[model samples]
Target: MRRATTVKFKYRPHPKQLQAHRAQVDELLYGGAAGGGKSMFARAEAILLCLRVPGVRVLILRKTFKQMESSVLPKLLEEIPEELAKFHASRYEFTFKNGSVIQLGYLDKDGDLENYQGPEYQLVIFEEASQFPENHYSYLESRLRASGEVAERMEALGLFPRRILTANPTGIGLMWLKRRFVDPYPPEKVWRPKPSEEDPEPGTRVYIPARATDNPSLNKDYLKTLNRLPEDLRRALRDGDWSVLDGVRFSSWRENKHVLKPELFPISLLSGRKVIAVDYGHEAPFAAVWLCKLGNGLIIQYREAYAKGLTPVQQAELIRDLSKDEEEASGEPIEVVADPAMWSRQDAGAHKTKDGSPPVGSQAHAYQTVLNRRPIKANNSRIPGWALLDEKLRIREDGEPRFLVYNTCRDTIRTLPTLPRSKTNPEDLDTSAEDHLADAIRYGVMHLEGKFSNLDGLDDYVDTMDPMETYRIAQAEF
Candidate 1:
């Protein structure tokens, strides 16, 4: 490596920024909204540090290679004048006259960290640190080393190498970083906390608020672009506030427009060819509801739910009662579907009735026994179930909602929309919240859509004849 020569460009730092640059702080976080000279500050600090220490090497990291090429790379070239631009572009590096060098790199993924393991740096910079996973930061920390001559000099002063991070507050690691740096001390002493019970780890982490007002030199065109953004996005960008992105999922939902007076749904839809779907839960309330489509319309009329958590036998009794109500009122064909997992030969446990019958059967014989006596069946697959429900909720050409909810099924109605995405996976939301009713509805739709069976003449025969008669006729034909 070639020795870097010392060079300095005059800079006028504000009181707060000057304090940030001069401090003996080990870890520094200059963060917040756009137009905050945070990025410029970070780059200037790196340049100043190299000037301070001869032959010093600095590593400036961004979240991705594209980011390095786009923001960091272009900004560095633009800020450093032609006289100092003698830096090596091919190596993604800059060399100062004093022998100090600055390298620009990106940590795009976990694997990217390994490339930096052996390289030693007197200073490290993480731009947009919030975009990275916590583990990536943790992994990089282990590689923080000031070896040989740098270590000897630092050892004498009792100061280790330092890191600077800048980012707007948003990401999966937001909670961890907030707890550690933003506020290490708890507000209430009585509220005992875990992780580090005492003071935070003896690591340096600082958070500085930066806004458009902090950077007066912002380009007028850029400011105009920021002004043109939509209200929420403009607020988030200009004020560094966190808000939800819309039009992807649950964007059209409005509480006032969707919520209506609570009451029982009409019986005409429920009485004719009904499907009862159930999602069983022991801790929370067990949910089972009656639903049927209105003609070919997407309106979903949910008749009722089997009220509370009950033993398996009691749930069975409840199902029988609801079945009788449907038979008497609508006299329409009825079918029931539940989670297939529930049909596994598992212990009914304390869910047994006074007669000692388990809510679920532990033996295959028991499942068969339930089949012989009840009007219920367990759905074997959920993907198909969800597809059925999705198909029925299609947005019509007229532009109304694809599905309508009757006021009667309040529990299902309230919960179907609030489910949050799974922390581990972004593709699917955690179905835990109002998932019971949703799953039950999914199964009910699947059962109605004839997805459960692929028999050639099954739908034609069922539409014309009773299932009992069709069963006898099929058996006779075989």
Candidate 2:
């Protein structure tokens, strides 16, 4: 048996892995295709960091205990020589002779994060990071800290309080992970948010993309397995494509193509039909969208309102308030559409219908009591609604996507891109995610079901109420 020297760890990094090893961002994601050596890079980094800093604390996590055992632990054990460290099976931790320790943990459910609330670790690494929720990743970042001697040791190398996340672009956390790391800029470059970004957390983050071909040592048959997956899944796992998520209904959505600023949207230019679409909720988010159906076959979400714990009356008042600008802009009455469930009868908690006694009525009745405007029941047909929404995302002849969301409509922009198609019925949205805003968008698009669907009349269908286009055409003839 060979005793370890001061630097006994032996490893050779491929070009892509070397980039992961060298990135100095506070947050780093080594992501992409499965065989990109993401897992191996995590293992090597943990070993090299732990081996370098005596008394250092490193915490590596997976979404489940099974994953901790199957994917992380075995390979980690193979990396660290026996004499340099002592592995505790019960604790799932390694203690080095130099007083450094590496803890292995799992974040499987909502309560699992509580296990880590009290601890501090200089380095926190998430294996298959996309499997955990954004909150889990976010909350754990607070735990990345060191003090006293460990801080002194880590700071010397400028390596204190760092995060390493490895993912394959498909998981519960895929949207947030992709949004935070992948979407902000070009890949393989360090990204820092400007002051105007939604999350302008000043810390530097980098996304290092990798694929199976980057590792020559990888088994050739793994590529075959990746190749056999469905197109969306294969694109995520085999091609390192962040754009396509498995079962994501709206793969056509691109922030650059669809989400527009005020300069590009030109809100003052709309003289078209408008509709106020609402998906009502009390404890959950009450979501609404002011959809402007413009003369040029462009659909823009001009205004958005979202809040939790608002009563039906409050939501109704909110609708009127949100509609005033669009109504004034279009110089016409805006149509109001709401969830069909609003019409369902509810228990009369306080007031009477007409007499003094308590009476059962619908939320819609309460809502109309405040605004005096009855909301039309939107078509709740899931397939056709999603289909209409999907079609609106297409690029028109003008080189802009027909469906455009204002940069200020943050909730719609946030949740719209994350709606994945259901596994049971691929045509419908998976209702598990935060889909209230998307529901509102769907209702708004479905309201335009007849117009602009077939290409024969898309350009031909001008705003019936707005005579501006007619005036422009007549003026051109003179």
The most accurate candidate by lDDT is: 2
Model 1 C-alpha lDDT per residue in residues 280-307, reported as the tens digit of each score = 6666666777766556544454555645
Tens digits of per-residue lDDT for model 2, 313-432? 888888887667666766666777788788776563544345321123677776667656666777665554565676678766777788888888877766777788777666567898
**Candidate 1: what lDDT?**
0.60
Looking at candidate 2, the ten consecutive residues that score lowest on lDDT are 451-460
Write down the TM-score of every candidate. Answer: 0.50, 0.71
Residue 392 lDDT, candidate 1, scale 0-100: 47
lDDT of 1 at 400: 55
Question: CA shift at 342, candidate 2, in angstroms?
Answer: 3.8
Which 10 successive residues of model 1 have the least lDDT summed?
242-251
Off by over 4 Å in 2: 1-8, 11-27, 64-70, 81-92, 105-120, 133-148, 155-159, 175-229, 249-265, 294-298, 311-326, 343-374, 391-402, 406-408, 422-425, 450-478
